[model samples]
Target: MGVQWSDAADGPIGGDLTAVLAYATPAGGAVLTPIAPIGLRDRDAGRLTFTTSLGFGRKLDRIRSNPAIALAYHDRAHGFGASSAYVLVQGRATIVERPDREYLETVVGPAAARFLGAPRRGPFWDRWLAAYYADRVPVHVDIERVVTWPDLRCAGDPVVDGEPLPAGPPASQAPPKKGAVPRVDVAKGARRLRGMSDLLLGYPGADGRPWVVPVGLRADDPRGYELSAAPGLLHPGARRAGLVGHRYNAQLVGLAMRQHTGWLEVADDGSARYAPHTDAGFAAPANKTLLLLTNGFLARRGLKQAQRARAAEAAT
Candidate 1:
C-alpha cells in the first residue's frame, strides 16, 4: 500500500517551494539535487512532481536505470504554509519525457504562477523563452514512505509512515577506492558554504536508496570537513556521498547554492568527516528578467547536449 500523509506532513510536502531530491546511482551511491516541486498533483494518493529540462538528460537516464529515490523537505523559508516538521519522502520515480503543450499550460503553468508569479507573455519574451518553457520533462514520484520529525531541526525521534525503517544499512557493492586526500581546497569550499543556511548530506540508506539529512559543520580537518548531525541518523562507514548548501529569498528569488561530491567517513562514535572530490555551483540572478534569460540560455545548451548524447548512444 502507498503511504498516506497526515495534515502535518502534507503542509510541508505541498507547500514548500523547493525540495532536495536524491536519486540512486548504479554504484549504489546517490546524487542530491534541489528541485522545485511546484505543488502536489495528487494529495490523497501521495503523488509529488517536479520538472527538469531536457538538458539534464544524464540525471533522467540515471533515474530510468534506478528509480529508487527520495525527497527531503527541510526548509520552510518563504513557502506557502507554516510548519515545524521536517519531512523526508522515500519513493519511486517515473518520467514523462515530453508533456504536451496543454498539460504545460494548464497544469504546470498555474502551479508555477502560485509560487513564482504569472508567466511572462509577449512576442519577444515568448520567442526568447520558447525552449526554456516548452522543452521540459516532468518526473512523478509515487510515495512509499513518509518520515516526519516534529522539530524542524530534526532533533528528536521521527514518526514513520508506509514502509518500516530498515534494521541496518543494506549490503551493497564497496565504494570505489579513492585517495583520502581532499581534491578541492577545503577552506574555499567551507567559505563558499558559509552564507548558506541549509546544509544537507545525502548517502545510501539501508533500503539502498539515498537518505538526506540536515548537517552542520563541526570543524575543518586537513583531510576534509568534519560535520555533525542528530544522533543515530548516519551509518558508520566510508562511502560515496554528496553535500549541498543553499539559500533563497521569498518566492525563490535571489538564490545561491553550492554542491560537493565526496567520500564520507563516519566514526563509531558518530563523528563524520567529508572529503570533497569535486565542487560546482551557481548563483541565480535576483532580477526576474535576468533569471529567465539565464534559464533560456542554459536550457538551449542543455537540449543540444542531450541530443548529441542521444545520437552517440544510437550510434554505439
Candidate 2:
C-alpha cells in the first residue's frame, strides 16, 4: 500500500539511526507537520500520520522527542537508473489514534483486532483494547512534505551544526526476559560459528553467567542459531560449575557472560531458560562459550553441514 525509505538523520555521533514508528499528538501541540503538499494546509491545520510495524509503547519515547518528522517512501514507478542504489521518498510525519472500528479496520486490515491486542473467539472475543497504551495512542503520520534523493543532495546531505540529543539513562538490559529473545540475531551468531568450524571454546570459568559469547564472529545472513555448544569448549571452572545448572545452554550458548545482553540459558534437566547479558559484545570473566566437546556433539546432532565440520573438530 505504501513505500518506505531510510531515515536520513544519523544523530550527532552519526551512527546508523534506527527509524522510529510514531506520530505527533495533535492535542499536545508538538512540532506540527502539514497534512498536504505545498503549504496546502496551515499550522495545526492538518494531521500527520505514519507507522512503525512495532508496538505503540516501543515508539512513544522517540515521538516525544522529535515530533517533527520526515518520511521516506519509494517511487516504485521510477527506477534507480542502474548506477543508483535505491530510490527515495520523503514526507512530513505524524501519529494518529483510530477510535472507530471501521477506520482502524481500513488501516490494519483483517487482523486489525489482533494488532490492537485483541483476541479472537473468546469470552471477550469481539472486544478491542479499550486503552492499551501507557500513553494510549496510535500514530498517524500524514504524507505532506516530500523530499527525495537528489533534492537532499542524494541523502549525502550533512548536518551543518546542531546540539546532540542527550543520551537517555542507560536502563538495565533486562530484569530478566520471561519469554524469548529475538531468534533473528541468534541466527546471525550461528552463521559465524559455522565459519570457525575448527575452533573450540576457551574460557577461564566453567560457568559464571550465560550469554551469546561471540569471540570474533561476523558474517552475512543469520538464521537457525540456537544456544547450544561445541565440545572441549569448557574451562576447568566452567566444567565443574555447569553441573549445577540445567542444560545451562541454548544453541551454542554464549559462556561466562558478565552483565545482561541478549541470550538464553538452559538448565541441567534439558530445560533451556533465557538469561540476559548486560554488556554489548561477547565479554569475558563472564563470557559465554561452548564446552568444546559438548558444543561439537550438539552440532553433530543438531546443526547441519557447516556446523558439523566445526563439531567434528570439537570432538577431538
For candidate 1, lDDT tens digit of each residue in 136-249?
A: 878888888889999777887899988888888644336566675689999989988887889999987878767899999877867899899998777788888889999888
TM-score of each prediction: 0.95, 0.26
What does candidate 1 score in Cα RMSD to the true structure? 1.6
Total clashes in model 1, counting residue pairs 3 or more apart in sequence or in different chains: 0
The positional error of residue 234 in candidate 2, measured at the CA in angstroms, is 43
Q: After superposition, how far is residue 78 of candidate 1 from its true place, in Å?
A: 1.0
lDDT of 2 by residue, 1-316 (tens): 2322223321100111111111322222111111111101122433333232223232344454444443222111111122221111123345454344554455433322322223234333222222221112345543333223332113342222122212331112222234333333444344333433211111111111111111212232232123333222111111111101111122123332221223323344422332222222231122222233332333333323434555677999
lDDT for model 1 = 0.83
Q: CA lDDT of each candidate?
A: 0.83, 0.26
Q: Which ten residues in a row have the lowest lDDT in candidate 1?
A: 169-178
